[model samples]
Target: KEVKKEIRNKVDAKDVNVLLDTKADVDEVNRALVDLNGQLNLKASMMDITATLQEQALLNTTLVAELCLGRWIWKSLRTKQGGLVPWNLQTANSDPSNLVWERDRTHIVCATPGLYELSIGFFSRRRPLVKVLVNSEPVLTVNTPPQGVTHHAGGRVSQSGRYTNSSVTGLTHHDFLALPAKAKVSLLYEGDDD
Candidate 1:
């Protein structure tokens, strides 16, 4: 029957030359081959970059680890009340116990600053409603979501550019800090297993 002939044709094409005899299938195979080649090139480039990073770290392991683990960076807000409340940029504070206040004036003092991406999160009870006030500028009232991630425990910015409200209207002073004289910062280990 026709089905038997078709099956035989498909099984017989054990090589590309046989597939090329069927022009349509040959074109499909060629397209797949092109995609695979492109993927291989990208993988090769990534491997090169990763190897470079590894070699550089090995050259300066102590300095690299100190930079990664010893710094505490934050964004600060100057308040009309004449003080500041520093917020950690790495962690998104959700008022874990209904303690995060909105409409409450909070001020922060910057320990160090270098073009920080500032943002505010608006939450009602437990859900994040919006994020506003990004890019060092403060807002009187937050009417939109913050520029970065929302409800993203990971602290990512949202794709849809939103800025939570902030009152960073008259704040100033941003600087960086180096550990104090003879300061020895070490990572505490509960056990060597860590």
Candidate 2:
């Protein structure tokens, strides 16, 4: 009779409540699993974005480095050895195959055919008839800012010859020319002081 009483309680409210509690626990676990999956997905998206940003940054840096090619700078030139400049600036001679330094003492031979920007700086109070020559031919002659002022498109001049606080007598001539392949470019700073 005692065993029968214990078996009847199994179908009563006390044991029935235990089954309901198990169902609630399972429901909570399902909700937690969904939240954890969402977190994983968010982490994956952030990683992808970070990877794409790194790739883009690398591409931009390479582009800037290429654009900096074919640039040259020479400073403190007291005398002209045939007016031929060996650009100490590394960017000018970045491509050794294209920019030939030892081929000719006065010229840089360009092996590629494309539009090139050439800049030549000199100190002359009179703007002494400076020009660009490609393959021994004149292409463009530069102009200066009025009588005693720095030009708008001129570079910063460090040597003495500052006529005024805002004016510099130095000239930075800039010209863009389409040069043919294997064409030699040189300068002519040959003029007497009058």
Candidate 3:
């Protein structure tokens, strides 16, 4: 009974609202659905925020497991050496590439064999370059490309705290997904075990 109640409570509120508004005008109803869907997406995103904070705490402890890490979000292109490379990050609306988000420690799965570089950082307007060795090939490189502004931007690396631009540092092994048997992948943020 308790579990059923919990499941019902977890149902998306917008879905219920949409069902209630089923008799509304077609175009108006569609607009309302879109707005409600946006709100629902926001609610779902809040889970990621909470998960990130909780993950930061769990990482403080010595326990390691996969669920501790959130799901994989996105990946970038590989470098000339077959390493993955990173591009300047831009906020959803802003142009000229200002503001950065942190990369999840266990983010990115190598679906194929190649060198890959990951750039992890946070909300700095300035772009800083940091090179991380992927597969011990010095394959990945993080750089801020120069523009008409005449100079490079700030660095991407965060010096302190669990939250960097968007990524949570100090990850545990639990944060990573299980790789295939022949995966050339390595954990970007090695847990205490490393």
Worst 10 residues of 1 by lDDT: 185-194
Top candidate on TM-score is: 2
* Clashing pairs in model 2, backbone N/Cα/C closer than 3 A: none
Query: What's the lDDT for residue 42 in model 1?
Result: 69
Better of 1 and 3 by TM-score: 3
Best by lDDT: 2
Per-residue lDDT tens digits for candidate 1, residues 109-186, read: 222222223333322222321212222233233333335534423333335345343221211222223332222211
RMSD of each: 19.8, 8.9, 24.8
User: What lDDT tens digits, residue by residue, belong to model 2 across residues 42-135?
Assistant: 6757778899999999998766545635655444332256454444444456667777665225567888788777776665434555656789
Off by over 4 Å in 3: 1-107, 114-122, 149-194
- Decide which is better by TM-score, 2 or 3: 2
Model 1 per-residue lDDT at 142: 30
TM-score of 1: 0.20
lDDT of each: 0.35, 0.63, 0.39
The C-alpha stretches of model 1 lying farther than 4 A from their native spots are: 1-24, 45-50, 59-194
TM-score versus the correct structure, for each prediction: 0.20, 0.48, 0.21
